[model samples]
Target: MARTRTLLTAGAFALVTALLPTITTVGAAAADRDGPGPVAVSESRGQLTVTVPPGHGGPGYRLLIDEKTLGVRTVRAGRTVLATNPAGGFAFGDQHATSVTTWSYAAGTLRIAAASTAPADTVAVAITPTADRYDLTWSVAGAPAGARTVSYQLSSAGHWYGGGETSEGAAQPYPLDAGQVSEPDFSPASYLMMEPYWYTSSSVGNYVRTASPMDVQINKSASGLGDFTIKSTDSYASTVFVESTPSAVYQDYVEVVGKPSKSDATPAEIAQPLWNSWAQFYTAIDQNKVLDWAGKLHAAGLGGHTIQLDDKWESNYGNLTFDPKTFPNPKAMSDQIHSMGYHFGLWTTLWINLDSANYAYAKDHGYLLAAAADSTKPCTVTWWNGTAGIIDLGKPAARDWYTGNLHQLMSTYGVDGFKFDTRFFDDSCAPAAGVQAGDYQRLGAEMADGFDLQGAGVRVHWGNQKYGFVIRAVDAGTSFPELRTTLRRSMAISTDGYPFVETDMIGGSLGEPAPTKQVLVRWAQAASLMPLMYSSTSPLGVVDHTTGKPVTYDPETVQLYKNAIARHGRLSDYLQAQARKSVADGTPIIRPVFFDFAADQRFYTTDDEWMLGPSVLAAPVLSDSPTRTIDLPAGAWFDTVTHRVITGPRTLSAYPAPLGVTPAFVRLGAPGAATAIAALSHQS
Candidate 1:
């Protein structure tokens, strides 16, 4: 009976195996016959295939990366849309080409030209191939009516990461079906960094090579492969880079777009942790309060080389003067801060309040952005504080005027630098004289050229990386979830090619409840591993609002804070070295874990962890629970807290993590690993 049962099971397996190949062959034959009408012109180079179908209703083309259809686009009278047939394959619908005008692959380039219907006279796509990568440029000549957008599609395979900065869902790859994503512009308030780039786990990368306003719209097909509809109001070019790993793809992107350029080396000040007065006082700051806070931080052995005064210090929003009411003698305060061995940095914004001293001067001289509704008057828009006019940084004279005030502050009051804030120039009051938003953002960074280190939002331009300021992570709240948000956004921004990353304050920002003792300690631990560790609320004096008194953290908790700061200080040299190297070759000092371990698929979707350059991996506990899991990449890793040697690709579950320590590891033989491990051990 047993032999009969075995024979029957083997016969059933043989029957299915015999039929599998026949079924697959039939499916392939059917798929091959489904074409996009008749191809008027076809060309192939490297791994790309360009097929142009003659345009009658519209001019369109389809690209296949190694025979896999990348996407299909058709331009009509008014709008352009990507067409996909019901069978999850490429199609042109009624936009099938009538004739091919120019079909030529000359001088290592493939150009396919076609004639379309009304509104669009002609449409063409030029492909420049290099190895496995392709530079795709499409031009739509004479579209006189609706939006003049540069529309194209990209493969949305595997997981997609990069649409500027957002704490919401940033730790995870982009949702394939999110439709139209929010905050698609270069607004730091909404999106901390607005970079026109994205990379997928499929080892594909895209960099929209335009300073114009561009929005990345993602739409996924029934099959996981999807579309990246780049809806730009202006014409632009883009590159689709392919490499063996995502890191290599990013390297190619930086080389093509242009690496960050400033001085030959990144300034050393970028690596130091600093204390600010925003969350600590919330604009209730005075000269005495500034000095007192600095003193308290010093006495507690917590403050770094910089003591920054945040919002509400200036008399008016854009006037750039100390408030005489709160800060009676600004110079004396600056001197006191300097005497305490700390750089005195003030918070500065580009908004000019209507009631400011310089409002009349700015409005009369056209230094402020003119209102689009009425060009004769300055554009007065509402912000967090109130209605104000934004300075036209796009204009040379206006930029000089703003920076002149900044220089005057430095010369008169011994101000070291500024923490530039509120950088977004919304569409309502923007491009007064047809200036692009990118121009304003670039000019803003250029203003910091002759100044000290200034923390600002990440700006993407040809050489804007040379601005020499740390890219600050978005401000977070005081809860465990917000702590996780800070990590997510910091990693996201760094991954976008802004290397020098600064995290939020040790605790949460204002309006949120004070961080709990455990939260504060954990936040400090996580921040300690980042490039810059900033603190606005000290762990020693977290306020218990219910009792109207300080929530005293135990000695152990205070020691944890000290250890975190000490760890950052000890690792400052290594961090600065990595930063300087980034200035040379556009590598990020703080990046996501998958960046270094791209071959390990286990970490492709991991977001809670990060890498410090190439040596250290930081997986700080970012939740209420102290225990966490860490997936170590391939190779031997030295555990900092436990002093244990672990091998990967391995995952440690329920790792013993307590409030006293951050979970970090050093790859055994990476550059500077020994020194880093020793310094971290000293802190422990």
Candidate 2:
């Protein structure tokens, strides 16, 4: 009988726990983690230490960053015990131990290679020290002749998160016990993206780099052991990177990975706000409304040069043509918009509608994944609309057609770029033709890269978070509850090392009823301090319940909105320069305060506020309260509004945050920045 590959149940994995793996708390008084064995520990200059146990599946590896224990984890529990019958000429005569045959530490490098019988050789693990992190590599002697799956897992203490869109930006507790995957997986409960990156309260970032697809399991053991598995179908080697960069998580990952930049954009374009039509008009939006709004926006002092024309303009998802009924003259419409000092962009996706004309054309042209064509059948993805045939990016010509259409929109109709939106598990739809998910991802990136404009905004999970494009937060609503979530989501994206990020807006995305006047002002106030301030909600769209008419912003509210944009415009050049540096070091322009103030324990708990670039720290009022309390790290800082120099290493009393202003302070830590507000004013 031929052996089949299946996910080993958590129950099956827990059985190995009986081996009594040795675990050390690293922190004082670790009880359950201690097992029978001597731990071989190694420390690096980067303040990271790793421990190896003497017994089989001993606590596995206990990791510590800055003397703070990240908990002990094991990687040996998932090693498959093969039961194939070699009698059918399927197995080699001799057998080798599937476990590590030898382990050694030399000159800051740890080599732990496994010896397996015949074709079942496990990867050789190598951990080398870098300036700031340990570069981990897992490789075989050469390319394997057959497909294989390998997994590396670990368990940590306290709270954990950082799995891109999968973790949903919320820190979740690992189950203290084990069980089967019982619930209908919703909101991407486990792994997200082809990239498997995660972080813990310990301030460590784990970057998984492999050509293979990844499966992440949290709380696989009832005892809360989280596991990350990489299944490589055709590769000979795979690598997963983990490092303790407690000082700066964003800078650490980008430095190890590649730094990304928008090559063609100017500094102004880099920091400019985006005006979106989604909330204002949805499918009802037309060229007239866009042009009319441009005038109104200018009158209201919110005119921006870039505009993103979101969904519903296209007749069909993948048709890639402007709806003739709604947009009769796209070229002229685009020209008029450009004349209004705006570069137009369209919202699009690779989703080919089954009933649309493009579907028939693509189906006939072999531009989709098919079954008889190897198990690589095309899958249907359902979203807010209905099901649609996914355009097979795994195929080159198919990708060409996809990009070609978008280019046509740019060259012919004056459409400058795209907001590439895709929220789904792409690996599930990968063709059986033996291509890795990265193939499709690279193709999508190719399409986005080929766009002439600098603002090719993409939601994560499609590919690695690269520089050339902007990263936007997933759609969020205007309610206080969802508002909090949206803010946290953006924080996660920043700390995850996405430099240029955009929150949906003050009043949220389309289909949302306008937020109350307070929410609108506060949201806008918060957004203005982010990397990019964008809005889909109009100034006067929020309805007044009693009058049944759009509520107009008071003069003060309008000035506040205009003041925020005007201020950002003046500082755009300086902001963009700081943003440009992230490509080399992976630093975040709009990041959590922990990046610079890691010593302050309060930063980890304060998720609602963020730092704009390296200069100002902003805390937006989340409630209807007139003032909100904030913890200021040890530093000399001045309120941006008042330029009042305040020394702080303590919590500030309820700070005043009126309806129109977001509380922000500029750091004056250096002698050159002694008058921080003055220094900032001069630069802007």
Q: Which candidate is the best by TM-score?
A: 1
Residue pairs in steric clash, candidate 1? Answer: 54-97, 54-98, 55-97, 55-98, 56-98, 261-466
RMSD of 1: 11.5
> Candidate 1, residues 521-640: lDDT per residue as tens digits?
888888888777777776667454334465666778768888888888788777877876787898888776777887788776676788887899988888778699999999999998
lDDT of each prediction vs. the true structure? 0.63, 0.55
lDDT (tens digit, per residue) of candidate 2 on 1-684: 111112234464345333533322232121112244433433332123445342321223343322111112322223211111111101112322243333455544555554455455544555543322344555554444333333223233234545444343332232111222211132221222223555544444556665455455555544244444445333323222222334444445565555565423456555567777776666667777777776677666676767778878888877888888878887887887787788888888777778788988987787875543244455655666677777776677887887888878788987877777764234455452566555555556666666644343665442355644566666676666666666666665665666676666667654566677677777777766676777767675544333446656676666666666666665566566666666656666776677677667677666666777677777778778888897887788777656677787878777886776567778876422333354244211
Q: Estimate each model's TM-score.
A: 0.80, 0.73
- Stretches of candidate 2 off by over 4 Å are 1-161, 166-195, 201-203, 211-225, 229-245, 248-250, 261-265, 371-377, 423-425, 432-434, 452-456, 460-466, 542-552, 669-684
Candidate 2 C-alpha error for residue 282, in Å: 2.3
Model 2 scores a TM of 0.73
Report residue 665 deviation for candidate 1 (angstroms): 1.3
Alpha-carbon shift of residue 449 in model 1 (angstroms): 1.8
